[model samples]
Target: MSDFLVVGGGVIGMMTTLQLADAGHSVTLLERGRCGREASWAGGGIVSPLYPWRYTAPISRLSGWSEGYYPELALRLYEETGVDPEYRQKGLLYLRVEDEARAMAWAREVGKPLERVSADFLYAKEPEVAPGCQEALWMPTLGSIRNPRLTRALHARLSAMQGVTLREECEVRGFRQAGGRVTAVETSQGPVAADQVLVCGGAWAAALLEEVGITLPVRPVKGQMILFKAPPGLVNRVVLMDGRYVIPRADGRVLAGSTLEDAGFDKTVSGEARESLWASATRIVPALADCLVEHHWAGLRPGSPDGVPFIGAVPGLENLHVNAGHYRNGLVLAPAATRLMVDELLGRAPILDPAPYALEGRLAGGL
Candidate 1:
């Protein structure tokens, strides 16, 4: 029996598994499909939330903690695996805001380095921006990473670590319980006994827990993205207009996305969404209108009812914990979330207050 069994092979599960294994625990991670090929692979890789001011306090806490930890983690990953996740401090520019006052106030409250720039200043900074965007907010401390690359690096690093086993193509069918504790997990291959179990199944978490009479409020939120191949230095930094964004990678590839749709588990990319995203991209950065659209794809984000992820022990179930429901911020929040989960599992002092993210705590509150 392994000391820990992590269900789901996304960024959250992989990070949690790595942390546990590094802490001298026997860990096995099970994934229905190939690891990290889900939402973690399809995200824009923005290290900060799209609209930081709009999210609740708990969300901010996780994002803040992660923003500080990702650079060091990326460096370590590169040193160990020789795989660069392309963690970049490119910053974020919000092109339009309905409540600029509120945004500025929130930035000040959070001690974020935010500056209001006029249209002329924005154009001087990023000449490719569309002409009509007259004002913007510049967040200098925000960063991004190549999500797919980061996931690959994590998988490789975890595989090389001692006492870590990754089981891809191993779909967890159900759980075996004894006296309200999940003692073992039944997989398609076979039953694996575990001292503890963590369900980080992303969008499928709710359905997985339902078999045990637990209803977690998480669902699949489909988001589609389009990729554009442009010359290097085309879009200087991440640009945001409303909720949609355009992220420029170091290799001259720009990612423009996405549409939040309640489309269940269907990840089909629609023509409507493609055109909409293309329009948004061109509208934000006029130069993108000329760039060749390489391809488009979609992923399912684990949408939560309260927008705050559940990251603690399961009520009434011993040796069973949860670390899912991160919605759209999984990549940005992965590092800190993993630390918090491992801290709880090891009975150590938590790095942050656990009340806001408690499984059964009140849904409304902030840090």
Candidate 2:
């Protein structure tokens, strides 16, 4: 039997599986669709948590711990799998920020580099931004990764690793519990009995937990994004304005995202979202209006209250755990979330405090 059975093959699940394997545990990773096809693949792969100052302290801590490890992790993945995750530390320029004092205080507290850019400096850096931008907050240490490439690299690496079983297209139907533990996972194919289990099912995690009478508040929040085929260096890095931002790829592709909608369990892109995102993109960089809107799509983020993720053990279930509810920050938060999960499972002191992320006090009714 596999030592651990992990439900969900998105970034969180995949990263958890890898970390467990690194700790010398045999893991069987099950995915509903092809691994990494969900929000993990659909995301723009911004290394920073979206609007970092706006998130809670737990999120900030997790992201802060994860940020320093990306460059090395990306390089390691590339070295092992020959797939470059395209981790680039370009920077992010903030426009129309509502709370400069709050942003400054947060930046100072975290020791993050924040620079106030003059209009001349900001426009010179990204000349296409909308006019009348007086000043901007610049964080040069911020970075990005190509999501598809990172997932691909992880998939390849996981497949190559010993004590790891990668099962794509295997849908976990439910969990079979006995004596305060999940004995096996009932899957579309058959019953997969592992010594332990983890539900990292992203948006679909809540339903899976409900099967065992555990009501976690991890629900699906829909976000839509539009991709543009633009010239390289057109946007000059990442630009944020009024909850919408454009990410420039090393190649000539610029990604504009996204809308926080209450649309549940829906991954369908919309004409309305396209127009809105296109408007946002062009407003930031007018040149994008001329570029081809190559692709438009949507992904379901695992949304939790206050943007805090639920990570760690299910209260009564001894062998089953979870690492979901990251909302829109999964890509940036996965490294630390999964790392700390491994530490918890292995009974080691994690780099960051795992208390705030545990399902104990964070959840409302479920215990």
Per-residue lDDT tens digits for candidate 2, residues 1-367, read 9989899999999999988899899999999999999999999999988688888889999999889999999999999999999998989999999998999999999899998889999988888888899999999999999999999999999999999998888888888878998888998889999888889999999999989887888788899999999988787689999989999888979999999888888788889889999999999989898999999999998988777788899999899899999988999999999999888888899989889889987667431
Off by over 4 Å in 1: 361-367
Model 1, residue 178: distance off in Å is 1.1
Model 1: per-residue Cα lDDT over 61-166, one tens digit each = 9999999999999999999999999999978888878888989999899999999999888887789887887788999888999999999999999989989888
Itemize residue pairs with steric clashes in candidate 1.
none
Q: List the residue pairs that clash in candidate 2.
A: none
lDDT (0 to 1) per candidate: 0.90, 0.90
What lDDT is obtained when candidate 2 is compared to the true structure?
0.90
After superposition, the stretches of candidate 2 with alpha carbons farther than 4 Å from their true spots are 365-367
C-alpha TM-scores of all predictions? 0.97, 0.98
